[model samples]
Target: MDTIISIIVPIYNAEKFLASCIDSILSQTFKNFELLLIDDGSQDSSLSICQKYQQNDNRITVFHKNNEGVTAARKYGVEKAKGEYISFVDADDIIPENSLALLYKEHDNADMVIGNFIEVMPHYSKKNKLYSPQVGRFNGIDYISLQLENKLYHAPWGKIIRKNCFNDDIFTTPRDIFRGEDLIMNIKLGLNIKDIKIVNTIVYYYMIRPSSCMQSRKPTLEYEKMFDRFLMLILKRNKLDTKLKKSILSQRIDALTGLLTEKIHLDKNDTFVKMIYSQLKISSFDMRQILLKTCLSHPSIFNILYRVYRKLSSITT
Candidate 1:
């Protein structure tokens, strides 16, 4: 029997929180779902934990594979999934019991359903207070625009997508880049979806750990540059409206600015700094105009000015 929904979790060295994550899913109010836990060469107890759960629950399926990245694990899980709708969950995060039920209820006549999420820190929890659209249906372009504008998040874990919206041919080619893979995947999926439903309910609990890749300070200029080029290609390929294109460009510029600011203290002659300078040149027309007006024609000048501004702002605050 085909399940109504399939939840795909890519597990890698998540022994600390794996059991809690699985338990949250098993305790969901909506029971007609299959859980696919893909263990990506975890050198920890995560595989044993998954096996323990699989022994008890028939709906839980575990697949162990070599050390591929999350993208490959998810693609493999999608291939094995036999559900009408698909959802992704990070191995260290938890979902409310009513998550599936609420999302499934609003899946009518929609290609995707999106819900809100809360961020759980070490000792404190913060709800994402971003303004979600009212409970209504939105077209693909509008949805993409909202995402680029940061009104909607680009993370894949807080949404449910119809399996039909995916093209197997495109999905099979796993992305090699790591930094912005979620945003790229979501953009690709959004291009295929016609209508999406937004639900203003907090369904996911995103745990913020210091050891996560997102928090890593290691600089990888090549991956970042690849992501920027990929975003540019997506913008060029999609027949988006003027407003949407502008919004996407603005988002890219903002990301570049943030990255530049973070690396401003590094040596001006560093390779990473040089690569970022080159990326900024091609990021967008608006960014270039801003740089020109700010008298930051050179990357070193820009970095110095930004660092001084940050210091002043911190002192004032």
Candidate 2:
């Protein structure tokens, strides 16, 4: 009862699992928490369900706003949250009964508490825990490096954060970042976090709904926006050394390569990506950027591959 945790569930057409998600929170072993259900222009009965739950539970607060995607909904909830600590839960996912209690136990010493989650698929479930290198509390530049280098879990769920860790300026320049919003939010949040604890216990049930899958992204103007937005965050952020910068470059290249696996598109984003290659410093390219663990950094090599890949795939229009 000393420091109540605020749990925010951003809802957008998640009516099917909304009830169960709410029930899981209501049945938490730790009761000293506030539940904020933010309905982001959901077309289904998600808002109604939230209203019904709020009618019965005094701690439940329901808010409705225009559909501005998950990041905006999350930002709205954070603005309204009154607790010292905050946690996010996708309305389609569920949290364990002791999840709040587990995260709460570490609040006094850590700026954030991140727990492993089990990915519940149709046939099986897999637990996600920390590896040896990611087993301890991290702070300052180390925290940023771990997060940017993909050393820590990027999802906002399964993590309890000190409310003050959120930097509002990151949200000032609104941009639609596809499905990478969670990682982007976490990247921004990491800058302000002084201490973060990674726990071994399972805390969330990330239900892998079969219908939740979407098509792979093309390197279109939209993709450019997402990448540029992330790059802006990196360049604008202060205190980043050579090591951290390389980590971010590696991560971005990995993502770009992953996208190219599905399909390569000739869009305006390509020009922007070329700039990224120049920034990496070709003179420092050790055996095709093997040092950075990136696929292709040279503009000519990347262009040749992209052109060949495009022609081979026969992608017109």
Candidate 3:
């Protein structure tokens, strides 16, 4: 029997990018694979587009579900998949044509195979060079550590994972923590992977749309639960390294600053916020790091000034 790969895409209202995303996967050099398109109750014409493709392609399977969310959609896909290895693609992104073939080649020996990505902006594209001109394999624990530190990606889109490595519990994701779901899942899944193969070759195209929720969301208590969960996960570890500790601190600072930037009217003495502030021993290097992170969030002069103003307003006596 051929080694079949399952490519899962959780889609909502993504009419414009849906066709291209599907086409890229269909055009993959590897042939023995199933394309699972989970339509998470889209109001747009996304379902019709998926059905049209399904009629002609036998490998395409379309599942229409009520609007749950990406994490739920992915869990449903995992339950239905019938392949030796699994991979993921975002509805708004494009996968490289040779990605499946490349990953499949290394799947036999590695529990997970990772490929680099290209960030596609409206007018320009940037090639992602996660590593310098080479391919290598490392222990899965190391990969998880790097990913948690934000040194490598935590998203599951660019990986091919062995199906047998995970138990059913691995798919469970907290419904409210949308922002950090990917990182959480990757960390849990990474624990099961004994060996990981990383290829520097481009295997995915990440589409950067103009409107991003990260720029506008208020990030209430429920939303901020991700940061809390992250802290707990890191703190519970028996062997906490210095790099991971810094990553936790960075996340805490980012969370606090994000709320401040949005001018959220939360209690000043809230335990979580107070704990984060008390722990913030911001060195010169950390200040520079914060500035770099803020700049990367948005480049508009008004945005920069607004954030700076809000940040200062919080400290006013």
Candidate 4:
């Protein structure tokens, strides 16, 4: 029998948390789901553990491919998925037992369903527990607005998308330039589809291990440049409304400012530095015009730079 949902999990060197991750899925209250474990060429015992699970459960399908990135692994799993709805789970993260059940129940008349998540550190530490401050229903067409307005985060694990959402024009695309690929993909998905549902339930447990890519202290500039590429892609699309356009550009400016600082600290002359600088020139002024939008969306950046930039731009303008 075909499953209702396909839980796509891309695994690398996740030996430490592999069992917990798999066990979480196995313990899901929704029984009509299959776990697609794609082993992205792990040099550790992760592949063996995946094989063990495959042996234990017929619903678990294991795919062993050469060391490809998460994007590739997910694409591979989607290609083989036989479920109506598709959900993603990181190899190190766990989900609530009734998470899938709730998401599926709330998936009525919507293209995608998004849920809440908690940040789980390696050990129970006060520093690792950061709950997102923004939460609500999103009725805007702007993908970046949803992002800027705190309607959604660039997390694939917290959302369940229809299988059709990963069709050829989307999932099979050759674009991999963005570090926040999930953001770009979700943006495209949001634009293409109209209905999106938000379920107010904390479903996923995000593991904040030291070696996690997003948590890495010394992340490379390429990852930072992904923000720039995402903005450029949105601008070139040229189909969004005025509000969305301004919001997207404003959000891009804010994101680039942070990326530039990170680059300045990490590498003085990374290849993307010049391009980002040029973008800043154009967006810096527009950011001032859309000052209210930026001020409300990203208060921290606005508080520090608002006075300084307002004074400097006033002199220049």
Candidate 5:
């Protein structure tokens, strides 16, 4: 029987968790699938571990390349993917046994099949199991609106996408924004996506680490620059409506708030905050509308107080 799905696992220095990760996939009841293990120049025993698996199972193909980022590894896997359905799984994460079965059922009618994921800690610590809401079938308008509100913009691993969703032109190109590159990649895929599904069944296990990007110290300019690129992508698409425009803008404000709050040193004469504020005003993001209608409903005084608190906190500590 032909394989229906291609699971792309980008391997790095994750030898500690690699065995269990592959085991979960191997244990899947749905047997018709190919596992592409791209070893991205791991200095540890991860490469050797992958080699052992490839030797044991012909269904698994191991590709070794020089030290490149996760994006590059995924791009390589996508280019070499032969299955009709394509999915991504982090090397350190695990997939539920029924993940492929449920996703395949949903993919029959969906350009993209999105499933819920639970965040697991070390030693399989279970705290706050997370699952996505039933967003229902989304048209183009719903897709844009849900994305800007940060509701539908889930992790890349939870979804099984049609291979044609990423044509040669989209996934092969190199993007400048290396950090938070997932946002732009999702947007690019979503622009062409339709008949999407939002299921509550948790199909993915997301392992949290203290050294992950979300926990590390970063320069605010990286985020600012990335969002700037995101806005440019939005402009070029010309598909978002007025409501969706407002949602995107509101999120941008929230992003700016965090960027400015971080205690990072800037250039002697750099005015990134000022530049971001200027862009916000022209971006036509109506925060007031979002605040009145959503969870961001804070009074003007609260906004002022929060700003003051951040400024003082930044200086005192």
Candidate 6:
């Protein structure tokens, strides 16, 4: 019989948790999947670990290539995958034994199946109590709205996507835009897919490492550019109604605000921050008009107000 699913795990410097991730996939109740371990030029012993697993498991395939990024590794995996359904797993994370089985069971009903995940901290592993519809199918617009609202996560790891939904044009963004690649890619996939299913089961375990890319304090212009382009793309979609466009615009503005305040530290004096501020001022969406104007016109005052807002927000939460 042909492979039912192809699981792609992009490996970088995750030697500490690689074995556990591989073990989780190997122990899955669905035994008819091939595991593709793409070693993205890790400086550590990650490649050796992948090779060791490849030797032990006949279904495991290992590919070694120059360091490109997770996006490139995933593209390579998809190119070589032969399964009817495709799923991704980060090397630092693990999925439940029934994760693949449950997703595959629903494969015939929808183009995509998304499962819930728990955030596992370094010191304490806590199961996240997230509320999601028990089992619901949605169109592309509603699915994207759920994702924008944070009800549905944007990561590729916890979802099972049918191979037919992917085309040659997916994941074409520049490799440097690492922060929100999953969001952009999933948006593209959601746009193409007709039916999407939400499964309330907690299937994947996401490790919240302090040094993860999402938590990094380093400034990168690629993330701002990516978000800008994402918003523009969504706005240009003629099929989207005014209500959906407004919802998407509002969510994207919030994302841009976080980029400016949290990641970039709101340094209006910095050249990159200034460039971002200028771009936000001329954004097509009116939702960000006032905030951008305030920040650009009186940065110091805006900073003070922002600080107060954060304090009040913390208190309310």
Q: How many backbone clashes does candidate 1 have?
A: 0
Counted clashes in each candidate structure: 0, 0, 0, 0, 0, 0
Q: Model 5 reaches what TM-score against the true structure?
A: 0.78
Better of 3 and 4 by lDDT: 3
What C-alpha lDDT, on a 0 to 100 scale, does residue 45 get in candidate 3?
99
Runs of candidate 3 exceeding 4 Å displacement: 123-136, 211-216, 220-226, 230-247, 253-317
TM-scores for all candidates: the values are 0.79, 0.79, 0.76, 0.76, 0.78, 0.78
Instruction: TM-score winner between 3 and 6, please give it.
Output: 6
Error of 6 at 244 (Å): 3.0
2 or 6: which has the higher lDDT?
6
lDDT of each: 0.76, 0.73, 0.74, 0.71, 0.71, 0.76
TM-score of 4: 0.76
lDDT comparing candidate 6 with the true structure: 0.76
Q: Write the per-residue lDDT of candidate 4 for residues 38-114, one digit (tens) a residue.
A: 99999999999999989989999999999968888988899899998899999989999999998998887677788
140-228 in candidate 6: lDDT tens per residue? Answer: 77776776655567788888888888876678766556566676677678688899888778778887665564545454445665666
Error of 5 at 256 (Å): 1.4
All-Cα superposition RMSD per candidate: 5.5, 6.8, 6.6, 7.0, 6.4, 5.1
lDDT of 4: 0.71
lDDT tens digits by residue: candidate 2, 1-317: 55478999999999889999999999999999999999999999999999999999999999999998888898899999998889999998999899999888866669888888877775445543223236677775676677666767677888788888776864544464565566666667777788888777788988877556655544554565466566555656564645576777656655655545545542324665665555565467433244222434332355456555458534421
Q: Which of candidates 4 and 5 reaches a greater TM-score?
A: 5
Q: In angstroms, how far off is 316's CA in candidate 2?
A: 40
Superposed by TM-score, candidate 1 places the C-alpha of residue 21 at a distance from the truth, in angstroms, of 0.1
